[model samples]
Target: MAAVETVRGLVELTRPVNVIAASVLTFIGSFVAGGVTAYPLQTGAAVAATGLAVGAGNAINDYFDREIDRINQPERAIPRGAVSPRGALVFSVVLFAMAVGFAVTLPVVAIAIAGINLLALVAYTEYFKGLPGLGNALVAYLVGSTFLFGAAAVGEVGPAVVLAVLAAIATLTREIVKDVEDLEGDLEEGLNTLPIAVGERRALVIATGLLAVGVAASPIPYLLGYFGAAYLVVVVPADAIMLYGVARSFDDPTAGQVQLKYGMFLAALAFIIGRGALEFGGV
Candidate 1:
């Protein structure tokens, strides 16, 4: 019973779903770039590395933010006493080392990207996270790189990269909404999130504009003859759902739960559509 509880606590602390999401996007991006010639083994290993990096990053963030989280999110594992800060930090280190090992199984590029991912997570947790727009952009860049990492692995950059970038924009847009959701907690901690710094109304407007751009940009590849029509057909509704989520958030900014889920859906749709189109189009 003690071991099972400990395992569950660690699993919750690591945020496995978020890690898996990164891995899935990375794998899909690699598949799209490589087309039919994609190496499943290489892609799987890269995804595993990405997942480990993401999990480790989360743990590190929890360790560093334990104090802040005590006030802002007392239910978090460390703050709730389910895990100690030192234990979390050690767990992060182990996961990061495992991620590096996994990265070495692939090309040098994967290793480099894995390092970048870890660094970005650290920077975000330590400093960037308090800097309003900058933090949001950093998160988006890291998310977008998963796709670019896939492309680099296969020695190609194509429509998949564009789609991934658009997906990142959508993610950034939703992150702003998340900031609004946490405005009270952030303000208590002196964290300068966009909603707090720019005012919630202005932040909402910016989020709306960004999401619009993301939706419009997502289908560009198909429009430009870079991908099959099916790509647009699949992504359009997903983008529409994202837009709806953003719009709804305007009514209740604390409803980030909706936006976050919608963002995840958008990413999943992008991956699925990108992969299906690339595979069936014979590109």
Candidate 2:
């Protein structure tokens, strides 16, 4: 049981939920780029590669953030002594290798994306994380690129770029909000996150501004005829939720974070459903 618990802790350290979410984005990208039946095997491979990459990235981030986690996330694997830093590093490297191996089986574009993402993940955790807006933007790009990687796997990017852009904007907003939430620990660790560099209030304003941009842009695909009414049905509500979150951030950054997180998920769902509806002649 002790060993099982340790294994579970190690898995949890990789943020499995986030990995799964990213994998879902990969599938959504494949579906949007070519439809559900297009390049099924390639889609599966992209999902696996994305999951591995995100999991590896999460582990490496935890390894680097062990000291900060000791204060901000005591229950984390490293902070709780469930995994050693060296062990986590090894785990991350192994996962990254597997991800790259999978990527190589796909097209050259996928391999290139995987390589770039791997380097970006390492750089973000090791160095860029200390820089305020730049770190957030890098993370946003990483998140958005998952869709592009999926499209690349299918040999075409198609309309998935719209989804990628939307995801990037929403993620950037959330990353900034998270920075605000972690301000105290970040300051203690001598990290100059946006909240610390520009003041919490300014950070909130910036986050809200980003969220507003995402909300405004959410309907672009439908208006451009890439999607349909079903897209509006779901995306409008998603936008409303994000807009509300942005408004609430002025008073409660924590609550705003929760709202944005849920809103982002809803927005992703909207993309999937909208695309499905169009493909199936639903709306």
Candidate 2, residues 211-273, lDDT tens digits: the string is 788888888888766677898899988988888886787778789888988888888899888
| Candidate 2: Cα lDDT at 120 | 97
Residue 134 Cα positional deviation in candidate 1, in Å, after optimal superposition: 0.8
Candidate 1 similarity to native, TM-score = 0.91
Cα RMSD (angstroms) for every candidate in the order listed:
2.1, 1.2
**Whole-model lDDT values for every prediction:** 0.77, 0.88
Supply the global lDDT for candidate 2: 0.88
RMSD (CA, angstroms), candidate 1: 2.1
After TM-score superposition, the amount by which residue 92's alpha carbon in candidate 1 deviates from its true location, in angstroms, is 0.4
The worst-scoring run of ten residues by lDDT in candidate 2 lies at 29-38
